[model samples]
Target chain A: MSDAALRSPLHAEHVALGATLVPFAGWEMPVRYTGDIAEHTAVRTAAGLFDLSHMGEISVRGDGAAAFLDHALVGRMSAVGLWGAKYTMMCTPEGGVIDDLIVYRRDWDHFIIVANAANKDTVIAELGARLAGFDAALEDVSAEIALIAVQGPRAEEIVARMCVRGDDDIHAMRYYTAANILLTGDIHAFAARTGYTGEDGFELFVAADQAAAVWELALAEGAGDGLVPCGLSARDSLRLEAGMPLYGQELTRDTTPFDAGLGRIVAFGTAANPRGAFVGRDALLRAKAAGPARVLVGLVGDGRRAARTGYAVTDDAGTQVGTVTSGAPSPTLGRPIAMAYVPPALSAPGTVVGIDVRGRREDMTVVALPFYSRAS
Target chain B: MATVPEELAYSAEHEWVSGDTDAGVVVTVGITEHAAEALGDIVYVEAPRVGDTVVAGEVCGELESTKAVSELYSPVSGVVTAVNEALERAPEAINADAYGDGWIFKVELSESATDLLDAEAYAASVA
Candidate 1:
C-alpha cells in the first residue's frame, strides 16, 4: 500500500521532526524520534507526547447504548457512570479475547469505545453483529477523531497548562473519567486521564483536522517541562514496563483475559450490581472455575541479553514451557525484563525460569506485573 | 544521511574494513555509519573475540538495541586478533561514532580479501 493510505493526521509533523516512519497496525507511524532509549528515558523522567491517531474509535449511540455494550462486551457497561471510563474486553463466545477496549460513557445513552488499531475493523464487525434487537447505532469514527497522549511524570502539569476552561476540572478529573473540555486557542476536546504508560497522563480526543494544531500546541507549551515528541518504540517499552498487555502480543485471539490475570475486567453478576447475560459470560465462567492453565508473569533477566517475543520459556528440565510475549531492556529498571505465560506452578514471584535468548539459557526470576511503578 | 567513508572498503553487509588487506595483516572492522543509525540505540554488542576464527559474510557476533537484535557479519575471513573491550560497558559508542571508537574487532586476514565494494558502490546498493 502507498504511504498515504495509512498516514495519520500528524504525519507531516512527525516527518518534520525527523521521526523514523514505519508501518505499524496498517498505519505509517513514527517508530522513534531522536532515539529509543532517549525517548523512553524522557517519558520516565519528564513527559513524552504521542500521536495515537492510529487507534480505532467506535461510537455507540441511542437509548440502548448501555444495554448493547453490556451484551456485546465482557464487563458490565451499565455500571459505568456518565463520563466514566472502564477498561474492558470483548471476547468470542469461546472465551477467547477479540480485543481489549476502553468504553467511555458520554451520556445516559452514548458510549465511545477505543479499540486497538489493527483490531478496530474486527471489533466493529463483532459489535455490529451483536447489536441486533437493541436500540443503538454503531459507527466507526476512527477517521473523524484523533487520539493523542501526553504521558509521564510531568504529563499532568504540562496538560494542565493548556486548559482554556475547566482547569480545576482538568486537575480534579479522576482517573478513568472523560469530559468535554476547552483547550488553548478555543479547541474543544473530549479528554481522558487514561493512559497505557502507567503514569499520570491525559489522552486528548479531538477532531482529526485539529490534531496537528493540538500536537504543535502541546509541544510548544510543554517545551519548558522537557516534553519531547515520542514515537512507537518508546511507547512500547513504556507500556511493557508498566506491565500492560499489548493486544496482539499478550492478549491474542486464543488468549482469555483470565489467562492474562485480567479476570477482574470480566464481570459476573453480583447481588449489589446485578448484570444480565453478556457474550462469553458462560465460557468465561467456565474458564474462571477451571482456573487458568497458564499465568502471565514478569521476568527480570540478570544480563543484558534480553528475552524477545517468540523466545521459548524453559523449565529447569530444559522443557519448553511457554513463550515470551514482550521483552526488552527496560529504560526504568536498567535491566532486561519480559512478560511471558508460564505454567501456574512456576508463576510464583520468586520462581526461577529460563529464557532461551537466541539459543543461550538466560535465567530470569518471576516477578509481579509492572516491573516499574510510579508514585501516586 | 549517514556517512560512508570513501577510504574504507565496504561490504554488502555494511561493515567497513580498514588497514592493510594483505594476507596476515590485521585489518580493523566496524559497522558503517548507516548500519549504526538503522539499529537505533545499541545497548549491547558481542563481537568475535581474539583467537576465534570468523568467516567473511558470515555471522560472527550480535548487535543488540532496544528495538531489536541483529547478527553481526564479518567483512573478511580471518582469525580475530583483537576485540573492542570498551564496548562491553559502552555500546552507545557505536551509535555515537560508528567508524571510530566503534570499531568492533581486528582480524588478521587468513588471506588477502577479494570482491569488497567501494564506497560509491556500497552507498548505491543500500540506496
Candidate 2:
C-alpha cells in the first residue's frame, strides 16, 4: 500500500474481518472478504455488506438547490418528491459524461448528490463553478459520513433487525427512497433503498466516528441472514449483470448518455415539461438528432474465454468494429458477458461479433443490456 | 504468512516446481499459495497441452480469476508430460489447495533447470 493512500473510517473493521485491501480511487478499501464468487453468490441468494464510504457525498442546501440541480444536471430534479432519489448524470458542455450521480431530496431545499470516488473533486469543482448564479451552497460531507450497504434478497430483514426504530418504515420502504432511522446505539442514520447490486438493499449513511459500531451491529443482527461482507469484485460483477454503466468504464468524457443508451436519464425540456437550460442541453440535443455513432450493447461469449476491457470487437471479415468497456464471467449466467460500444448497425440483439481475447478470436452475440435481472 | 514447501523450487513468476532439476526427469508444477491468494478465486486455467514444449521464463498458459487474468509461465523448459485435467471442471481447487490438488502440470525435463530459487529464498523475495 502507498503511504499517501487514504483510509476509510471502517478500516480497522475491514482488517479485523480479514478483508483483502486494495487502493482504489485514492482510498485503501476492502476489495473482498471471503472470496469474490462466494460473496457474489451470497448477495444473490442471501445478503452482502459493502463499505461505500469511498464514494463522494456532497450536500446542496438553500432555497435554490433543486433549481440549481435542474440547471446543472440532465434531470428534472425539481420534480423529485421529498425523500426521493433519482439516478442522474452531470455532463460537459459538449454533451460528454462527467459522472453519473444519484441525487437524494432530503427536504424541500436540501439535497445530497453522491458521485463516483475518483470524480468527486472534479464534480465538486464543476458544481461549485455552476453555482455562480444560484442561491445555493455546496459542501462536501464525504468525510463526515460513512456509507454502509446491506444488499441482497435477505437485506431487508437483516437491516430491519439492526434498527432500534423504523422497522416498519424499512418493511414499507419503496425503492429509490430514503428514510431517517435510529440504530442500536441510538445513532441516527439516513438509510436509502438504493444499491449498485441489482438485489434489494439499503445504504445507511451514518456518522464516520460510529461506522464501526453500525458495521458490527449489522453483522451481529444479520448473522442469521448470511450477511457476508463483500468487496469491489462482487460489486463490479453485480453492477455489470444489472447492466448499470460504470463511470470510468462504460461512461467517459468522450461518450454521451445517448451513446451509452441511457438518454432516458437526460430529461430534455419540451413543450409540456419545460425545464430550464441545463449543462450539455444543446450538445445533447444535437446528439439526439444525429444519433450515436457507437451504441453501447451487451455481449455473451460462445466460448469459455472472456472478452475483457479494451478488447477489439471484430466483424466476420476480421475488421475492428468496436471496443469492449467492461466484461466478466457471469457467475449467475455461467457464461462470459461484456458491454461494448458498437455501431448502431451491430447493436441489435443476436448480432454476432468476434472478440480478440488475447491472440484467439471468441465469437460473442449481442444481447439486451442486462445479462441478469432479479425476479420481482 | 504464505505456505512455502521446503522441498520445492520456485520461479520469480510464482510457479512452484518439484525439487529435482536433473535432465530427462519429470517435475510437477503448480502456482504457490501466495500467487493464488493474490489472484483471488481462480475461475479458469489454461495449461499447456501434453505435447507442447514449454520454455522456462516464458508464458505458456493463463490463469483467469474473478478480478483479472495472469499469464502462467513455465519454470523449467520441457514437454508437458501430464496435466491436472480435473481443474477444467473445478478450477477453485487452486484456491482451495494451490500446492496439492492444484498442481497444474508435470513436465519431463528437457535440460537441467537453471536459476531456480529454493523455498526459503523465494519466500524471502516475496516477503
Candidate 3:
C-alpha cells in the first residue's frame, strides 16, 4: 500500500527520531525509533511510550450490552463492573478462536471491546451476528480512537505529570481498571491501567486529533526518567518477555483457548453467563475435559540463535513435535526465547527439545511461562 | 549516519573487512553501519566458532533483531580464527558501533584481498 494510505498520529515524530518505518496491520508503524535494544531497555529499566492506535476499538452499547457480550465472548463479561476490563476471546462454532480481545465495562449499558487490528472485521461480523436478537448497538470506532501505551516502572509518575489535574489520584487506579482523566487545558482522555508489556502502566484512549499533542506532552513529562518512543520492534520483544500472546502468533482461527492455555478466562457456569448458549462452548468444554492435543509453552535456547516462527520444534530424539509460533532473541533475557505448541507429553518444564534454526537443530528446553515478570 | 571507514574493505552484503592484509592476510569482518541502520536493532549475533571453515557468499553467522533474523554471509573464504566473545553478552554493540567494537569475526583469508570493494565502491553499490 502507498505511504499516504497508511499513517499513524506519530508518523512525523517517528521520522524525526530516525525510526525505520514498516507497514503492520494496515498502518505505517515504527519498527524501531532509535534502536531496538535501546528502546527495549528503556521499557525494562525506566519507561517507554508506544503509539498503539492500530489496535481496533469497537463499542457495544444499549440495554442488552452485558447479555449480548456474555453470549458472544468467552470471558464472563457480566462480572466486569464499571471501570473494569477483562481479557476475553471470541470463538468460532468449532472452538477455534476468532479473536482475543479486551472487554472494558463502561457501564451496565455500554461496553468497549479492543481487538487486534487485522481481526477487526471478523470480530465485528461475529459480534453482529450474535447480537441479532438482543437490544444492543455495535459500532466500529477504530478510526476515531487513538491508543497510546505508557509502560514501565515509572509509568504512573510520568503520566500524572502530563495531566495537570489531581495527578495523585492516578496511582490509586488498580491494574485492569480505567478512568476518564481531565488533562492540562481542556484535553480529556480515557486512561486504562492495562498493558501487554507486563509493566505498571496505563493505556490512554483519546481523540485522533489530540494524539500528537498528548504524545508530546507525555514524552516531555517522561524525559527525565529515560522514557523513549518505542516502536513495534521493542513492543514485540517486551510482550514476548511477558509471555503475552499475539494474534497471528499465539492466537489464530484454528487455535482454541484451551490449546493456547487460556482456560482460566473461560467461565463455564456463572450467574452473568448467557442463558441459551454460545458458540464453541460445547467443543471448548470437551477439550477442557479431555485436554488439548497440543499445548503452548515457552522455549529457551542455549544461546542467541533464536528459534523463529515456522521453525520445527522437535524432541531430544529429533522427532518433530510442533512448531514455533513466536520467537525472538530476547533483549532483556540476553538469550533466544520462543513460544510454541508442543505435544502434551513434552510440555513440562525442563523438558529438552530442539528447534530447527536454518536447517540445523538447536537444543532448547521447555520453561515456565512469563520469562520476565514485574515486581508486585 | 556513521561514515564507512576509508581504511576498511567492504562487501556488497554490507560487511566490512579490516585488519592486516600483509602478513598471512588476517582480516576481521563485521556488518556496516548502513546495514545496522536497516536492521533497526541488534539483539543477537550467532558468530561462527573458532577454527570453522567458511566460503565466500556462504552464511557463517546469524544476526537477529526484534523484527527479523538475517544471515551474516562471509565476504571471503577463510578459516575463522576468532569470534566476538563479547557479542554473547551484549549484542547491541553492533548497533551502537557497527564498525569498531562490533566486529563479528576474525578470519585468515584463503586468497588475496583484491576481490573486495573499496569504501567508495561499497557506498556506490548500496546506493
Candidate 4:
C-alpha cells in the first residue's frame, strides 16, 4: 500500500479476515473478503456486513440550518421530518450535480449530510462557501466517525441480537428513519434504516475507535445467519443491480439531476408548501419545462459480455444515442444488467437497443430502473 | 498465494504455456492462477479462432472479469490449433481452476520464444 493511502479504523480486521484490500477513492479499503460473487450472493440471500468508514459525514447545525440547506441542496431539506433521511443532490448554479448525498434531519435545527468518500472534500468546501449569509455551522466529522452497515433479510435480526441498549422495538423502525442505539458495554451509536444495497438494512454510525467491536459483534451474531464480510466490489454490484446512480459514474458535474431522471429531488413550483428558494431553482425549472433530451434507463440482456462504464449505446442501425454509466453481471438476475443514458424515445421499457460491447454491438432490452427490489 | 506449476513455462503477461519444445512444440496456453485471482471472477473469455496465426507477445483475445476487461496476449508465435469452446458458456471455470480445465487454447509453436520465463523467475516477478 502507498504511504499516503488513508486506512480505515477496521483495516486490521479486514487484513485478519484475509480480505483483498484495494485503493479506492484514496482509501485503502477492502474490495473483497472471500470473493465478489459469494459476498454479493450472501447479501441478497442472507446478510452481509460492511466497513464503510471511508464514507464522509458532515454535520450541519444552527438556527438557520434548515433555511441554509434548502438553498444549498436540490431537495427540500426543511420539509424532511425530524429523524428522517431523504435522498438529495447538491448541484451547481447551472444545475449540474456537485454530488448526490443523503440528508438526515436529526433535529429541528441539526442535519447530517452523508456524501460519497471521493466527493467529501469538495462537498465540505462547497458547503463552507455556501454558508456565507446563513447562520448555519458545518463540521466535517468523517475522520471522527466510522460507519458499519448490516444489509439483507437477516439484517434486523442480527442487529437486534447485538443491541444491549437503546430502542428495544428497533424491528418496528420505519425505513429512512434513524435512532440512537447503544450496543453491549453502552457503546453509543446511531442506527438508521438506510442502506445502498436495496435491501432491508441498517447503517450504524459509531465512533472511529468502536468500529472494530461493532464489526466483530455483527459478524459473530450473523455467523449462523450466513452473514459474510462484504467489500466495495460486491456493494457496487448490489447497488448497480438496485439501479442506484454512483457519484462519479452516473452523476457528474456535466450531468444534471434532470438529465439523470432525478428531477423529483429538485424543489420547484410546489405551491402547497413551497421551499422558499434554492440554488439552481430557475435553471432546474427551465430544464423541467424543456424536458431532458436524454434520460437514464436500465438495460438487461443475456451473456457475460457486460456493457461497462463508458461503453457506447447505439440504436439497432448502429447509430450512437448515448453511453453506459455502470454495468455488471447481475448475480440475482443471472444476466448482465446496466444503466445508461439514452434518448427519451429509446428510454422506454421494452425498447430494443444495441450496446457496443467493445467493437461488437450486443442486443439489450431497456427495462425499468432497479433490476431487483426486495419484497416489502 | 496462487499456484505456479513447475512444468509450465510462464510469460510476463501472466500466461502459462505447457508443452515440449524438443520436437514441433505443441503447447497449451492459459492465464496463470495469479491473473485469474487478481481478476476476481471470470465472466467472459474471448479465445482466438482455430488455425489463426498469432505473434509472440501480441494480443490474441480478451478476458472480461466482473469488474473490468483485460487483453489476453499470446506468449509465443504460433498457429492456434484448438480453442476452448466450453469457456463460452462457463467462463467461471477459469476462476475455479485456472490451469487445468481452464486452458484457453492449444498452439503449434513455430519457433522457440527466447523471452519465456521459468517458473521461479515468473513467480519472483509477480511476487
After superposing candidate 2, which stretches have Cα over 4 Å from the reference? none
**Candidate 1 C-alpha lDDT tens digits along A147-242:** 999988888788888888867777899999988888898999998999988788899999999999999989998999999999888999999999
lDDT for A61 (candidate 1)? 95
Question: For candidate 2, lDDT tens digit of each residue in A1-376?
Answer: 8999989999999999999899999999998888999999999999999999999999999999999999999998999999999999999999999999999999999999999999999999999989988999999999999999999999999888888899889999999999999998999999999999999999999999999999999899888888899999999999999999999899999999999999999998779868778999999999999999999999998777888889999988888999999998888888899999999999989999999999789999999978888999
At residue B53, give the lDDT of candidate 2.
98
True contacts kept of each: 0.56, 0.44, 0.80, 0.52
- Measured on C-alpha atoms, candidate 2 has an lDDT of 0.94
Residue pairs with backbone overlap in model 3: none
Estimate the overall C-alpha local distance difference test score of candidate 4: 0.90
Stretches off by above 4 angstroms in model 4 are none
Docking level for model 2: medium
lDDT string for model 4 (A178-216, tens) is 888889767988889999999999999999998988988
- The Cα error of candidate 1 at residue B100, in Å, is 1.2
Query: Chain B alone: TM-score in each candidate?
Result: 0.97, 0.98, 0.92, 0.96
Clashing pairs in 4: none
Each prediction's TM-score against the native? 0.98, 0.99, 0.92, 0.96
Local distance difference test values of all predictions, in order: 0.92, 0.94, 0.87, 0.90
Of 3 and 4, the candidate ranking higher by TM-score = 4
Question: By lDDT, who's the top model here?
Answer: 2
CA lDDT of A44 in candidate 2? 96
User: What is every candidate's alpha-carbon RMSD to the true fold?
Assistant: 1.2, 0.8, 2.6, 1.6
